[model samples]
Target: MTKAGIIYVVGTPIGNLGDFPPRAQTVLAGVDLVLAEDTRHSRKLLDHFQLHPKLQTLHEHNERELAPRLISRLQAGESMALISDAGMPLVSDPGYILLHAAREAQVPVRVVPGPSAALAALAASGLPTDRFCFEGFLPPKPGARRDRLQALAAEQRTQIYFESPRRILDTLQDLADCFGLARPASLSRELTKIHEDTLRGSVGEILARLRDDPDSCRGEMVLVLGGAPAPRDGPELAPVLLPLLAALPLSQAVAVAVQITGLPRKQVYAEALRIKED
Candidate 1:
């Protein structure tokens, strides 16, 4: 039986080549094959580092078909690396199928971590990063996009999204409409490149700036939106507390009720006991 080979899910720079780690360079250079979302685009990165490796396309359209063949190659003991055009693979990018297949086959997979546009934007955005969610790209069609935004209107965690230059303005308009004009947001574009710029303001203000300066809309974009504010009034407790107390142990029920109601644990525990007594 032939020993299987390893798959390295490498991360490339989003913009500045300087952000590419040395470990990523070594892995890419040593790998027998490099699976790229775009062979043409990835070739430039390889050439910049003076490294030559076999490049193959593994993008959205062909990933499902290509994954099985690639897995066979790995089983045959050929080491491979997977990379997107920028950032990590499988982040609003392709490669999930291949990675999932590799895992099922028990092939060893490793990550050569590096820059991510979403992380870079969020870090620089000065928003609450303690608890956040990446929403990737919103729906492209107007109605679908608006519907999606409407669904996320109540999301409490800071949200990150990737947007294209062509759709930035329109997306901002919809974000303002759905999330409210005064909601805080940060728009970071052309990150890590010389012309990198991050505009932080209310959704409406950022929308106004983009309209005033069309050039800002160019290049890769990441939008970070503040979460919904906590409700001012606490919800009435009995309806929330009674069911939990009945179904769960007193302590467990109180803990869950606290999470759901955003009320003090002590208060929830007291209410739990009172309801039990009643």
Candidate 2:
């Protein structure tokens, strides 16, 4: 009996077809079948390299239904390759279910790494590459998206995100609001393409650049945000106490602020008195 075949998770170019590695082309050509996120898009990549492997559509909507059948083929000694529309197969795309199934069925699986937009953006952004996080696409809705950003506000490691062209402004504004305008950030768009560019600065600065050069918002984007600044040794007294002072009597505000800040009541009370006297 023939040995069970392998599944190769191949990465294609994020942009610039020249970035397609020779090994990836060979795997796509050699596989018994090639699974693609979009057959039309994948066909262009295949045609570029003169590959004519059997093609099958396997996207988010249909992956669940098709993974089992594909796994069966792998078990039956039919080698296959999975490719996304761009970048690594499963970074922000489909192929996880089928890859999982392949491993569970004891079929050999290999990776053919190529261009990845997230890593590309990060590397070029000059952010700390030692530790980072990949947050693939933020929530489309403003409320939910803001909430998500709020949760990541204190993340110490660099944050990476893939974003859509249309939502660039909204996302930048949201980041400015949650993370504060001074937080450093980098935005790279149309990566590896003709007009590819990276804008690096504080979040507010990048937002202004995007606003002025509306053209920057026209393609796929990867955002790299500097992690929140390390917490100060003591509570931030002023921003914390101002609101309470507005709504409460001086003594009451001081009492509340002291408890909340974990600062000595004497200092808070004195600060409250100064604000009142001013």
Candidate 3:
């Protein structure tokens, strides 16, 4: 029996051809077949690198029907590489069915890491990145999108999202309404392409700029938003007041604690008195 071949889930550059790594180029040149989200788009990339491997469409519509046959080919020792129109495959892109099927069959699989628009935007956004979440594209409908944002209103980690040029304004408006107009965010569009531009500021500020200069809204976009501020109440309130009360007089400490917590002055004063007594 022939040993099964490996499936290379390769990552192509999101935009700039210079970002395409040599390893990806070599893999594409050597693979027996290349499965792409769109052959026409992938062709230009391949042509630029002078690397031509047989191309086949593996988009969302046909991925399910195509998985079994592709698996059979792999099992028979024909190595294949899966790539999206840009960036990594299976990230807001197709190929999940094929990769899952390959795993079940115990076929070897590997990944060629490359550029990611979400990470790029987050890094450029000046937002906290130690903990973050990726929320692909949101629902298109106004009501549904607002509902989704409401659900994530209190998310403490930085959030990343993808939006199209057409819906960016509406989405930003909804985000401002849900996450608050003053929330810090960054909007990156065109990625590494010639027209690449990133707008960083409050959700309201970015929205205002887009409104003023509509040309800024053209091309693919990635939005990185600062997470909701941590709540200071109940148990957490004690730690805040205790330190202030120890360092300053009752009245001054309560005043500082109230400002820090953004809680009711009455509530903070009561807490301060209680801490002083203890």
Higher-scoring candidate on TM-score, 1 or 2: 2
Q: After superposition, how far is residue 9 of candidate 1 from its true place, in Å?
A: 0.4
> Per-residue lDDT tens digits of candidate 3, residues 1-278?
11239899889999999999988888888889999989999999999999889999998899999999999999999999999888988889999999999999999998889888888888888999999999999999999998898788778799999998899999998877666677788999998999888999988899999999999989999999988777556567888877777789988886566545544445566677777777
**Rank by TM-score (best first):** 2, 3, 1
lDDT, ranked from best to worst:
1, 3, 2
* Candidate 3 RMSD to the real structure: 7.9
Clashing pairs in 2: none
Q: Choose 2 or 3, whichever is better by lDDT.
A: 3
lDDT of 2 by residue, 1-278 (tens): 11238888899998899999888888888888889989999998899889999999998899989988988878788988889898998998998888888778888988889899999999988888898999899999999998898778778789999999899899988887666677788999899999899999988899999899888889889999887665543236677777998999887786666445534344556677666676
Once model 2 is optimally superposed onto the true structure by TM-score, how far is the C-alpha of residue 144 displaced, in angstroms? 0.7
> For model 2, what is the error of residue 38's alpha carbon versus the real structure, in angstroms, after optimal superposition?
0.4
Give per-residue lDDT, candidate 1, residue 131: 98
Per-model lDDT: 0.86, 0.83, 0.86
Output the TM-score of candidate 1.
0.82
| TM-score, one value per model | 0.82, 0.85, 0.83
